[model samples]
Target: MKILIAIDGSKASGLAVKSAIGLAKAMGKPPTLVLMHADVPLMRRVAAELGTEGTRRYHQENHDHAMKSARTALKRAKLAFSEKLVVDDAGPAIAKAAKGGKFDLVVMGSHGRTALASALLGSVAAKVLSQSTVPVLIVR
Candidate 1:
């Protein structure tokens, strides 16, 4: 199966990776995995608050940290697979990527967001569940 695993460098994301791995192992073939890491843009805003040089440093630091997180998640997953790191909204990007890739399934960790919080911010899992034509496996 072609599987897309969404990760955010959190413990929850690690669980999602583990679940995907288990599924792939159970299927008796290495599934096509798309490990996605999404990063929120925060540097320019920080710069506006701190000034030019401060902003530049902040941007650099954030970028490094984001990349580091992506790499760490990938390493922790310990799977050989294709990966995508997106520097925008995660939910939309994940849904778009899944659709574009023609994946059969999407596996992700649930953050256990309350109904109200989910409604207000829009959960990524919820967005994918609603938008994706393929099946989504939400691992809590």
Candidate 2:
């Protein structure tokens, strides 16, 4: 099975990575894994202030920080995976990557928002569940 794991350097996402590792081990096959981080676009003013090289460095640092936990977990588990960084909204970016990669499943962490809060602030997991063509496993 091919799996796409969305990570944001959070405790919840660490759990999700662990779960995916377990799932892969239980499957008795080394499933293909992709660790993805979505980078939010910088404001025009901020971009201008930072310049091209500085902006690139900033985004690279963010990606490294976001993927740190996931990378460590995967390495500790002796799992081989690829990484992708997208500059877009999290939910849509995840969904698009899942679809484009033709992955069997997408695993991600949830913030466990209440219905009202989800409705008001929008949940990434909820959006991925609604928008992704592939199945999504949300680890809380």
RMSD (Å) of each candidate, 1 decimal:
3.9, 0.9
lDDT of candidate 1 over 102-139, digit per residue (tens): 99898988899999999998898898888777788998
Best by TM-score: 2
Candidate 2, 37: how far from true, in Å? 0.5
By summed lDDT, which 10 consecutive residues of candidate 1 come out lowest? 62-71
What is the C-alpha local distance difference test score of candidate 2? 0.93
Q: What is the lDDT of residue 91 in candidate 2?
A: 95
Q: Please estimate how well model 1 matches the true structure, expressed as its whole-model Cα lDDT.
A: 0.76
Tell me the tens digit of each residue's lDDT in model 2 across 10-36: 888888999999998888779999999
Predictions in order: lDDT? 0.76, 0.93
Give the number of the best model, judged by lDDT: 2
